[model samples]
Structures are given as structure tokens and as C-alpha cells.
Target: MRLTALALLLALPALRADEGMWTFDNIPVQKIKAKYGVALEPSWLKNLQLATVRFPNGTGAFVSRDGLVVTNHHVGRDAIAQMSTAAADLVRDGFTAATRAQEIKVPGLELMMLVSMEDVTAKVNGAVKPGATDQEALTARRNALADLRKADEAKTGLTCEPVTLYQGGEYWLYRYRKFTDVRLAAAPELQVAAFGGDPDNYTYPRHNLDFALFRVYEDGKPYRPDAILPFSAKGASMGELTFISGHPGTTYRQQTHAQMAYARETGIPFQLRAIERQKQALLALSATSPEARRLAAEAIYSLENGHKRLSGQLLGLSKPENLAKVAEAEAALKAAVAKDPALQARVGGSWDRVAQAVARQKALLAEATYLDTGRATLVGRVAALRHAIALVRLADETAKPSAERLSEFSEGNLKATRAQLLSPRPVHKAIDQALLAAGLEEARQALGDGHPFVKAVLGGRTPEAVAKAAVEGTKLDDAAVRRQLAEGGKAVLDASADPMIRLAKAIDPFSRAIRKQMEAEVTGVFNEQGGRIAEARFKVFGKALYPDATFTLRLGYGPVATYANGTGTLAQPFTTYMGMFDRHLGWGGNAAAAEGGVWTLPQRWLDRQVKLDLATPFNFIYACDTVGGNSGSPVVNVKGEFVGINFDSVYEGQGGYYVYDADTKRAVATDVRAILEALRKIMDAGHLADEALGK
Candidate 1:
């Protein structure tokens, strides 16, 4: 959901009661026609119902025309790397197709289209009732959706997926046809593709030029499928109806206030804390281990970016003005519910229950933070125990025949384990020590060493002694450890001689008991007030709502321009080569200089007087709604012609996922002209330029 802080700043002017229904789906087609003076096309509606291409990890776009397809540079980077060699690093040097034959093929990459959608809401909800617990409802809904998907897949040639659109009940089966032959047509240098680096990410006045071109091939030729649509640069008519067809991941708009409150209080904070820890962990490890550094780079970037965005949302929610708006909206909803006897009877207590839940969990909110740190200490011991058990199983199973040996040993398990141990911040020592200490303390406090599991694991040794040996004496590199399990086989499994194994057996039941206790306490409070809040929210916001975005395709539109939010005026559209030079100069404590950094352009750029390009005002900003998943989305003119590629939104704009404003809702997009110019001249990727521009 968009953060309430930004929502308050861009609050729509109060509208008459009648205007509410106009934006809602209830309004007739004629009413929209009369107001917007444009006929809503049946084709547009059909297109809206279609799904855009999406990769396994959320990267894809529709087939635009014939073989032409669009997606983000970052998304296609892996494929580009796979197709490249040290002598031809597409990521650093970029690629361009001078002609159709020169296009680079990406093996195993694919495109998918949503061919059909069936509303399965009734089937899902029928499995569980209104009074059912969340877990029960979730399980029931999942099972029903699975059954529905299986049935649909049997009938249709395409793959069918049953998706929950609005939490548990609102479900739809989206059918898709997959194509696996996609190729790269063009790309830009990292300098241009990720222009602003980390600082400009998720912020406005974005200088990023994040776009990549690819094409779909079938039978060794350009695929001209029926799904491809011709590019239309004119865009939709101003003030006219338009529809965006894409795979929108998730939205939180439909969430009850109680759920949102949970997010605001418990969920977001926990996420922030976890992210912080991860970032720190990555940095510490990266400082020493080159392999670890490379492996953690992507993870660190994702975590840091998410942390920044969520932090913005939390700050937005904390604003007094925003809270007031929420309260006012809730009050109005309650009034509406009180007026409707039926609704009141159905949802009267929901809000109170939700509130009680929130109140009860207030103290326990920090539990997640504690667990985040604690888990790092516990997981290693668990892993060691599991590894030992696996070895014993492998030995027992190998007695049948040489060919019957378990696959685990031949696999990369040992190699991966060694690499993990070599990481600068290996978790083994800490985890073993923490688990050993905690287990011993618990045994002493509860049943003493007499408890069978405790006696088997720790009866002969003190906690301190075990901890010291585990932390300082244990050698992860010891071959004997692997051999001992390999030889012992069934004997090890039958005996409880291993302390780690004994502790591991007890941990699950202990953890479950703790979780149950916590849930019971929380649910009891929720049963009191949660229901009342949910009902109140529904009355105020109505049934049609958006869910939280899960980094999926969503269409957001606004104008082009910069914004001022006390951080300093963000120059809209873009920063020029001159500005890049200036930034470098400032960084080097020489801002007054005219020429001394990476921005020193090629002779051609200089010959053009730099002013020719910088002064042309080639860029425009808009409060277009976007999020992380929105990256690489085409920023089109009203006629739906691609003008630029959407990359990042500003920090202030992070909250825009929920609430959009005509102001402050800007996305960073690379201008099509600049991209073309870079390809044609700077990068000498004339072939790619020709295909992209249809030259």
C-alpha cells in the first residue's frame, strides 16, 4: 500500500458523495463516455484482461510487434552474461544487432502470455467460512485452488495457475502459454544503464537509463505470433480511458485496517531489522572473502533498497496528518456500518478484535528482532546435526549396491558446505555455542540432567565445556567427522551419543510449544477487537481494494516533472553530462572546476557544445506510480507508444504504490532518444539502434 504520509500530501480534494461511484466499476460505460468524451474500446478491455510476460524471478514483458519484446536491463543481465565471454563482456561493453541475423540468442530464456483468466472466488471461499481462523481459511483456499488448477490444466493446453488476488477468497486461474526462444537485440553500458548508481535508486530526478531490447524467435526465425501488438507512439487520448495489461504481483489495498496495522507495527519493523542485520552481515563478510563478496552483492543491494523503501513507508505512516486521515476514514466507516443493520450484525466486532490483537502483541513485537539475531546462532548447530544424520542415512542406504549409493555425496553438497565454512562470517561456531548454552540452561531449569534427551546430550559435560569445545576446538575440515558417520551407519541412528542430534530432536517440539503459546495469547486478543476494525475498514474503504505489490507487473500513470520535499529540489527529466562532471568535481572537492572527472565526454559530445544536448530539455518527469517490480516497464505516451523505460521512483514516491498523487508521484525513465543516440554513436551499436528505431 502507498504510505499514508505521501497520501496525505496528495490527498484528493473532497468530492461529493455521488463522485465516488464514478471511479468505481459500478458506473455505466455511457457515464464514462459522457465525462471523458472517448469511447472505451472493447479491445482495450480485452487487452486489460491479458497477462504480460513474466520470468520465474519476475522479469518479462509482452511481445510488442512480430518478434519485438521489452524487459529491464537488470532482468536480462544474467542471460547477457551467459552469452558473453571475457573477450566480449556484454555487461560492460554492451551489444547491438546491426541486422536481424546478428541478434544474440539467449538459451533457455522464455516468454509467457496469459491466455485466459477464470474467477474462482466462490470455489475458494466455499471451502472455509467467515468465522474460520486465518490458517484454516488459508489451507482450505489453497487446496481448493490447487484442485481448480488441476481441472483447468486438464481441459486447456496452456498451464493454469490459480492465484489469490485479494488474500484468501478472491481467486482466479490465469492460463499461460510459454515460449522458450528469446534473444537479445540491444543493451547499454552499466554506466548508462545504471546511471545514478545506488544513491539515485528509488528516488526521483532519476538519471538512470535502464532499458534492454530482446526479441522472440521461433524455428530459427523471428516469431510473429498473434499476441504481438504494433507499437503506437501517440499514447491514449488525454483524459481518455486507457487500460494496462500486465501481471500485477500483489497489492495491499484490500487489506483490513487490522492487517495494515500489523504491517505498520510488527511486520515492517521486523523486516527493517532483518534487512539491517543482513546488510551488516554481508558487508562484514564481503570485506575479506572475494567469493563471498561476489555472492552477497545482489542480496545486499536488494536488502538495502527494500530497507530504504520500507523506512520511507513507516515514516509516512507515522506522520500525524496521515494518522488523522486514517482515523477519520475509520470513523466514517463505523458510522456507515451502524446505519446498516445487516452489516452491523455481520461485522460489528471485527474492529475491536483487531485492536485487541495489536495491543496484546505490542510488547512481543521485539521478539522477531531478538529471534533474527538468535537464529544465526542456532541454525549452524542444526545444520551440523542434519548433516551428520544425512551421512548416517547415506551409509545405511549404500549397502545395497554401488549404484544404489545416495546421490547426496556425488552432488555439490560437500563443496558448498566447505565454501560456506570459508565465508568470513561462518555461522557454525556461534550457532553451536548458543544452542549448547541454551539447551543446558533449559535442562537445568526444567527437568535437570535427568531428562533422557538432556542426559544423552549433556549429562557428562558442563555447558561451558561443551561451548568451548564446539567453538574453539571443533574442526569443520576434519575428515574423521564424515568418516565416523559413514562407518557407524545404523548404530549412530539407533544410539543418542551425538549431543547435536539429541538437541535437534527436541528443538522442533520446543519451538512449536513456544509458538503455540504466543499464538494463543495473540489470537485471544484478536478475537476481542480484530473483527470490529476489519468491519469498520470495509465500511470506510469499500470492498474493491488493491493488494500490496509483490514485485509484479502493475500499470501506473502520472505526469512528468520534478518534486521538492525539503531534501532539495530534484531536477526533473535528468541531469546532463555537465552535471555528472559537476557531481564528480564536488566529490573531489573541486566543484568550481569545469573539466576533471569521469564525465569528461568524448570529443564528439564536446564538439556538440554539450549545450546542444543538455539545453534541449529532452527529459520529462511524472508522478507515475511505480515500485521495484515496475522496473523496465515501458513509459509510454498516451497512445501507448514506448517513450522510455521505467527504472526507479523517488524515496518520497515509495509510498505511491498505495496512494498516487498527480504531484510527487514521479518515476525515473530513460528517454528513448538518448538510448538510441547512445547505441548509434557512443556505443557504436548501430545495428541495435536500427532495429529499435525501425530505421
Candidate 2:
């Protein structure tokens, strides 16, 4: 893993300086050394890798040698919801374990540490010829991948996943060690954690603490891993070089103009409208009562966040000036490919092929997205119909040999599918009802009310009535019922009298037909051609290109700096504790009044002990090339010292997915000094503070 500059420059010639999410094995050390006079050594990398961890949906890092994990509070909201009860509402009061024994383990939350990674591009691509038909290539690739995963797992005994990097140009087999037993240690009151609320989410000079702590356990004890991040209380200053270590969920810098257009025109708009509708619904539902509000808080906040993100993205994309830049980049790339005969033959037609696929998708988007089977999960968003569809598909796929089955339903995924289908979780009936009714109505609009499957799902009942009946009548809330149907296979599903099951059976054929058509025309074609296009891109850009993020651990760097703010004001690089208290004052005179006001600050935040150091930094801004998944990442200095916790990005940062603007778009982080101060003074967790500060 000794990265070299020649290796980087020669490897990816098209890579834009300061733009790539370089893998550890191929980091541009010479490049970094030249720019910032700092190059990460092998030991530095090992410590960084060991310190960082991946959650099911987010990222965090070890703050203590004893396995204490620190991440954004929003990342743990679902666990908070699960751990809450009638008398002991962790979400409302927040949880702080005075001692190690008091920490409660939350089920279903898992953390993973990257164990190893190996180049597997040749092995995977070896299965299909360059000229193979789309269908042939797709089938061969699936078989090779399934075999590779099974063999690797049996060999290494780690969770092995094949990462598709540079679209299809390269591949890596990433292995991870799983930690299923993670316990919630401490969390601040929601009001204090989300001080600025939705309005402050992506803005600079943020006062939000927005952090939570947890512990990873094994054999009923805190399992200290080899790779713990050394805590550094020393704060970052303006213009300091910093690096963030975490799995950024995704970025689309490699996407073609047509693909970006598809998202801008079809995907973003549809998703924004849906999010707004759901936000309105959730707000109305929560307004019903205090209890309702408590129940819906996490969900509502999520919708609000999504709404803002999409709205920002749409606004950025709609700008004609931005589109012109995008078009210019696309034209240059296309021209480069056409100029080279070899590149033309390879990636010459890729852009056009992708455009064709996108065009086809535009025609099928509505029917595909709103395709409903009238079933909802315990969580409002998950469609039981999809599980129902999966079950039916599983039966069909299972009937074939392992090689012939769809990759998703192959032997590798079957166990996970079964576990998910049979896992028990609490159901919020009202939420489920609203979701199903909304789904049914959407289905009517998309597929038309006269569609046979739509009529069957509605069953002559109105959308509201049908949805209500489905929620009230179905026994899917019980894991046993779902298990019986899933385990019993197709015959059981066909014979079941349960209204949801019957509806699932009725819609299976239509769903299956759609799946078949999509695979043949869209997915299969895209997979084959996409890889060739990737190869072409590699030829054009060489080592300079960074692959689209696949939720894998990555290293990206930037500097702590200030950016221009509209209205004749320049936003400061960091917000101080005094600013937080000042903002708190704007809420109300006292903690109680503030807690009841906008961006509620908890009573403890007004502690007199912490008052003197109100000048301490609370949160700060930095321009880092990061996207959504970077939340909760460990922001470290050149020496990899903890500086802040990467949480939200500015409104312009939403465009990071499509374009990386290092100037205006920046990342927001909770200052480590502020976290220590809060723990020491307001929360009175002096021991935890010492542990984090390495005192």
C-alpha cells in the first residue's frame, strides 16, 4: 500500500487534482506531499483505517481505546427510537450512562471495520468477453461475482463484497469484520443536538452539537480493536490542512451529461414532490398530540432534510450557467473519445448508449416508481409489496440452479432476504395506513385506475378504505405470519387468504413481467455497456479519475477556510460557544423557555461552569470534497488528529454529487473542543471527556 506519485499520475491521467476519493492502496502521496508537504505513512494509514468504522447507514470513528464510537446524533436516531419506552424515553430525555454497566445494547444496529481489500478486476472481467452480448455479459458477470463472494467468504471468514469502481473499469473485493453488538453510551437532548433544526442543517456558523457516542461489544465486553483513533483535544485553526476519514455514501462526478439530465429532469423533481407531500403529512400527523410529535420527530426531520437536499440540488441544476459548464465538459469528453480511433471503438458509443437507456427510463420511470402492490411494512416507507414481489421472484429464481438465478436472489443473498423477511419490528399503524393509501393513490395516477393490477389492489374499494383495511386486516405485523408465507414458498403464497398475501399473489405476474422487461432492456444492457464506457473513461482520464463512491471507506482532504455569504456578509469559518449561547438567548431568556422555543437548547446547556469558556469553538466550516455519506466522519488534521465531526454540508454542497465546487460548497462539523466542553460542563461526563481527550 505504499502509494507513489508516478503510480497515481500515470495510473489516472485524467484525475483532477484535489478531486479524487483516493483508495488507501493507491493514494496520491507524492501529490499530497507536494501540495501540503504532508504524506501519510503506512502506520498513519493503519491508524486511520482502524479508527474509522461503517454503520449500516452512516459512518463513525473510535473515540476511545475501549471501543467508544462517536458519530452524529441523527445517525443514531433509529436506535434512539427503538430504545425509547413509555416511562424511559431516551429520545426525549437523551441517554447518558454514568457507568459502563448502565449502557444498553440496541439490537439490529451493526458496525463494520474494513479488514482488507484486493484487486479483483481481472478475475471478475475474465468471465465475459469484451464483445459479448449484453445479456451474455450480464449472466456471466453475475455467476463470476456470486462464485467469488462465496469462495472469498469461505476463505477469509469476513464479510466480502465486490466493489464496482470506475463504473466497470475496475473492481475490488472489500472484506469487513462485523460487530453486531453495539451499545448506546451517551446522547444529548434532541433540542441541543439539533440546535438550528432544518434551517441550520446545511448553513455555516452552525451551533449544533449533533453528536452521539456508542460502544462496540463482543462476548459481552467492550471489544477494543487494533485500530483506535487517538483523540486530540487540539482544535483546528483557519487554513489548517485537514483530512476526513469515513465512507461518503455517494457522488456522481463520473456521470455523463445525459445521466445527470435524467436525474435532474425526472428523478430529483419526482423525489422532491414526494418528500414535500410526506413532510406535510408527517407534520399534520405529528401536530395531533405531544406523543404523536415525539413519535414522528425523527421521521419528520429526515423528510425535512431530504426536502432541503433535493430542493438545493434542483436549484443548482436548474441554473443555466451550471448546465453550460456541464455541457462543455460533456462535449470535450465526447470529442476526446471520437478523436482516438481506439477510444472511439471502445467508449465512442457509450455516451449515446447511456443516453438511449436514460431515454427509455424516462418513458418507464412513472410506471416503475409508483408500481404498487398495496402492502406496507412496519416502517411507513418500506413497501411490503416489494418484499412480496421479492418472495415471488425468489421462488422463481430458486427454481433454477444457482448460476441461472438472478444475482440479487442468488444463494449469496437468499439468507439475508429470508432474515429480513422474517425479522420482527414494531409497526406504527397510522404511518403504515398513510403510506399505503398514498401508494395506492400514486399507483392509480401512474398506472391509471383502469389497470387490472390497480383495480385488483384497490379491490373496488377506495384508496383510503383499501389502505385502511390492509393495515387493519393484514397480519404482516407478526413476523411469524410473514415467515410462514416466505418459508412455505409459492404454493403457500398462492393459497393464503390474508388480504395482503392475496393481493401480492394477484400482482406477482404483472410485477414479474415488468422485472423481466427491465432486466432485458435496461439493467442488463446498462451493466455491459456501462463497463465498456468505464474502460473508455479510464483511457481518456487514466489514473486521474476517481470512481463513483460505493459506500466504501475513502480518504478526501481540504482546508479549514471561510466562504462568501450573501447579503454583504462573509460567514466566519467557525461558530463559537458564545454564539450558541447567544442564539440560545434568541430562543428565550432561560433554558426552559429556550427548550420550548425554536431550535431548542436543553437546560443543561446553560450550565454556569461552562459559561466562562463560551468563547470556545462550537462548530466550524471546511471545504472538503464530500457527499451525503460523509456525515459523522472523523475530521483530522495532517497528523490525523481529531479536529471535528463531519455532519452536514452547506446548501451549495448538495451539488457535490454532480460537481465538486471547492470554493462555495463546504462541509460543516461539530468542533471537538465544543464536544469536550459540553461533556465536561453541561453533561457532567468528566470521565468520558478525559477518555476522549486522552487525559
Candidate 3:
């Protein structure tokens, strides 16, 4: 009991207080009871787990028995954009289906709910010897995990995902039921749903109603769900215990200082610059026409969101407090390992090995960012380079025996891959060509004017000309054309005449080689050495610490609380509808609105204001830990009563992905009362509101 004595001696409040994004199976029962004097029953835990669903991009919660899921408006934006048109722009005006028949089916929209979980650490680690090279161990682990997943899927007919927890210190086989037929039910206008723009995002005392509704359908009818979160008419109160249930995407809490520095310097900065450039390109394109504006709206939103998120993340990372905390945690981990003779012998030098790999990877990052990750600005993310790689990889991987290919191309993921590759999404040639050129140019700049890939991509042609040749020459816009090539395999790729196909074929060898190199140098070392560090941590902190987020179901509990609102200002925990209107008018560009820009309330909402209670809660702040993927999570009380819907974390909480600062970090959510009020008063969504409230 390395940690037991330290736990008692230090009496650390971080471990005791409401913290951690805990897996459903690993709830801190004693801690919860101690903090709130409330007990969570087994049945309640199961129900809560079932109620939460993982949308492709974010989290959602079941609000009705017929599988009506509520998620952030941003999460559902893609579906909405796809369903919208120039005439009936569902995204701009917002939409509310008066009847089930009127609800529009969103093609390729998918969600997943965790059905069961089983520990599989032993099976995964079974193949590796006590001591082995990082690459050997990683290759064995990946192959084993894939084989296990394939077997489980074949046996249970469920989506079997092998989740590596604590950076592979633990592993679990989580089975999920996938829902592909999701339909848009009701959504508010874009203007109101995202009431405040980028400036308001990640801010507290917010009034935005950032929520949307979708329904899961099976066999042409609404699916009856076994679990649902019942919404309360009354909102949450200050200092009350709060819980957030959702699928948080990713966190790098256990990364060493060197790795974090790489992110802070090369990775994050490069991404921010890329996003800013993309934002400008999108805006410039969207200004061409009203329809162009409509189609590019979601892209613009994504760009802005990314820009703000990365900026905030950098701010958090730069903070002395966060840096000091990381150093302290790293020091403690090292000390813990040194105290245990066996562990010290096993992992004492793991960190140095990781540092060497990090240094190597840092040099490759710029090229990797462009060619491998396809983050290159000139070629853009969705251009010919990726499309080419997909075709080549598909051909190469599918040529191998089903079990030999990577998990991404394995038998278990074919359906998902096909759905994405062959989905009938609209395309704007101008946007495509522009972004493609940007990515290509970025490749040239990062790699060099004389780089082989750049030369091949350019093919002695101008970047714009090459881009036009690729976009206009490729038949990938047609799903059937893509399917034919994908099914044709390597021989077909070799024989193909399509410009994009030929380009992919030419670059495939180089890209594949780099990928292989990356698999060994960076990913392998990080996972192999990171697992050792995690073991060291477990020795010191034991099971008291929670694993990092991995885009899975988790719950983080804290208190509904207030904090300093920056510059010695005391911020309130909650905001009301009255404050919303007051701020709107104050900042609505009238004579009194010296703060700038106009914000208008809908005429319907304005007319109904007299009949409604302006005092109703609009948004609230809580101490729950959250990150980007936690959007649309259900914010509830200890008894599992819905109080709000999570959409953003306060600026201070940007560090939440790496550290939880109880003093300043807070989760910002739209009050359930606000959603209900808007539905009943503004949107005339009375029936839907009644159903959510069980009234």
C-alpha cells in the first residue's frame, strides 16, 4: 500500500473533493456519500449510464422514452446543415416538426450507447513478454486488441471497442449498440441557439440556449429507450452538488513535460495558425453568395470554435499554476516509482526514452501535420491527398487477409467506413479547390520548395492548377465512383487513370513509409513508456485517480458554485432571462449600446415576454470537470435530476483537459428551465417541452 500511507499523511483535498471524469463502473461511492450524504443505488447508476448517448461529435442524453436525444446545437449542426437547402434553410431559421411525419431524416447521422463493459487487460498484455522493444510490444498489443474486437463482434453482434485506459495501464472491452437512423425533431433558430458568437463562447453568466433535439429511429419508427433523463421545471441552485454525464473525447493529463512542450510549441501553434487561415478562406468564400454563406456556415462555426478553443488551451498551458502542477505531479510519480524496488527497476528510465522519441517526433511534426495528419493548409483536410490515401490504403489493406489489416480497415469497421466514404454529402467546388490549394501550398512551405512530395503534388504545375486538376479530374464526388475504386483493391488503384487516383498512387508509397516510421518512433514509445509512468502513478495514488477521457461515457461531479469573475469581480453562479434581455438591449447597437454590435430577440419571443417569467434561470456555472467533447452532456443534481445541458466550459476551465482547478474552473450550461421556457414561449414547442418535463 504505497499510496495508503501517503493518502492519510497528505490528506489531499483533490482526491476527496468532487473531481474526476469517472468511468461508470468505477464510481467513487464512498467519496460521493461523504461529500453529499447521498447514496447512488445500482439501478440508478445503470439508468444514468444508459441515458447518456455518444453522438459522433459530442454527447447527448435521452429526454423521452421514444429516444428523443438532446445535444448541443453545434453537435447537431452537421445534420441540420445537410438536411437544409437554399429555400428551406433549417439551419438559418431553425426547425420544429409539428408531427413525427414532418421530421426529416438525417442521412449518415450516427450515435452510440455503451451497453456493457468487461476488463480485458490480461488478454491484451498476454502476448508481450516482460521486456520487449516498444514497437514489438505496441504491435502485439494492437494486433491482439483488433483480433479480440473482431472475435467479440462476430460473437455478440455488437460494436466491440477496446479502450486503453490510463495510457494502457488498464484496458476494457466496451460493447455499444449503434444507432444510424437519427432524425431531427426540433431546433431553434441559429441566431438564438448560438445567441452570442465567438466572444461569448467559453464565458460564464451566459444566456445562450445551446441545445437541439434528435430522435433515434428503428424499423421506420421511434425507438423506445430503456433510460431517459427527466427534466425538472425548477433549475439548479448555488452550492448544490452537480454531476455531468457524457462522453468526454480526449485528454493528455499523463503526458510528460517534453510532450506538452511539443504541443505548446509546434503542435498547438501550428493548428491555431492553420485554423485562422482556414477561417479567413471560409469567410472569403462565403461572402460570394447567400447560398455560399448557408453552405459554409457550419464550417465557419467549426473554424471559429477551434480558434477560440486552442487560444484558451494555450492560455491555460502558459499559466504558471498549471505548469507548476504538472511538474509537481511528475515529481511525485518519479518518487513513487523510486520507493518500490521492482517498479523502480522496471520504469525508472521510461521517461528518458519518451523524451528521446518526443525530440525525434518534434522534427517530423510539421511534415506529419501536413502529409500524415492531412492538416496541411494548401491541400486542406478533405482534398485529393486524403481522398487518394483512402483509396490506396483501402486497396492495400483490403488486399491483406481481413484480420491482417489495421483496425480502421478491419472487418468490424467496414460498415462505418463505407457509410462515411459513400455518404451523399453536398460539395462546393470553389471551397474544395480553394482549401486544396491552401493545403498544397502549406506542404510546399513546410516540407520545402524542392521536396519530392511537393514536386509530385505540383507536378510542375501551379498549386492552383494542380488543385483544379485534382478536384475537377477526380470522380470522388460521386459515391458510386468511390465505391467502385474502393472495392477494386490495389490492382484497380494501379490501373486507375483519375488524376486524384494517380496522385494518391504516386504518393502512397511515401505516405505509407512515413506512417510506418511514425507507428514505431512516436506512438509506440508514447504508449509503452506512458504505461510505465501510469503504473508508477497507480503505486503512489493507487486507484484514487481517474483515467483520462477517451470519448466514452463518464461522470464528473462537483458543486454549483461561484468564483472571481476576473480582475477582482465577484461573479454570480447563475443568470436569469431578465439578465439575458438586459444584456441584449445593452449590446443591441442602440444609442445606449456603446458596447458595440446588435443582438435582436425574435418577434415571437418579444411578444411572449410579458406572459412569461423573466426571472427564470437562463444559464448557470458549476465546478464539474469537462472538455470539448462533453458538450450536450446532461448536468444533473446528485439524485440524477436534469438541471441543465452542458455546452461549454468557462475560459478558466480550458485547463480542465489537463488539470482541474476547483477555485476558478467551471462548467457553463444552459438551464433546463431556459430550454423549456424558450420551447413553450418562443418556439411554440409546447408538446415537446411537456414531454421532456413529463407534464
- By lDDT, the candidates rank as 3, 2, 1
Prediction-by-prediction clash tally: 45, 10, 7
- Compose the digit string of candidate 1's lDDT tens values, residues 638-673: 344456555565676554443333345455655566
lDDT string for model 2 (1-695, tens) is 34684554343322221566777777777887988899789898888987899986689999787889999988887787778976778876788889999888887687888978988888888998877877677778777877888788889888877787776668778888888888998888787788777767777778888888999999998987777665678889977888888888877767778778878888889877777766676677777877777777777888888888888787777777776777898788778878889878877787778788788877866655655232122113744544555666666778888887767677765655665566554556666666667666767776787888678777788877876776787777677777777778777776766665655666666665665566666667677677877776677777766677889998888777666656355567789888877776776655445434655565555546345487888898876777777888999987777889999888866776787665567788999998888787777577788887767
Runs of candidate 1 with Cα error greater than 4 angstroms are: 1-39, 45-51, 56-59, 63-66, 78-90, 96-111, 129-134, 167-169, 218-222, 228-251, 254-266, 289-294, 359-553, 567-619, 657-662
Q: After superposition, how far is residue 396 of candidate 3 from its true place, in Å?
A: 1.3
What lDDT is reached at residue 686 by model 2? Answer: 78
What TM-score quantifies how close candidate 3 is to the native fold?
Answer: 0.93
- Provide the TM-score for each candidate, comma-separated: 0.67, 0.91, 0.93
Tens digit of per-residue lDDT, candidate 3, span 1-695: 87895664343223322568999888998888987787988898898899999987899999888878899888898889889889998877788988888888987677898999988888988978777788878877877777788788899999878899998798888999999889999998776677777778878778887899999999999999998888988778877788899988899887887787777777788889888777777788788999888877788888888788888778878787887888888887788788889999989999898889998898787766666633344444564456666777787787687656755677656555566676665555667776777666667777887888777767778777887887888887676787788787777778888887776766666666666677789888998989888888877788888899999899888877766658565566788889878877777533443322325555556667786789888888888888889999999886677889999888866766666677656788889998998888777788889888877
Best by TM-score, which number?
3
Candidate 1 TM-score, true structure as reference: 0.67
Top lDDT model:
3
Clashing pairs in 3: 377-438, 377-439, 378-438, 378-439, 378-440, 379-439, 379-440
In candidate 3, clashing pairs total 7
**How many Å off is the CA of 325 in candidate 1?**
1.6
Worst 10 residues of 3 by lDDT: 8-17
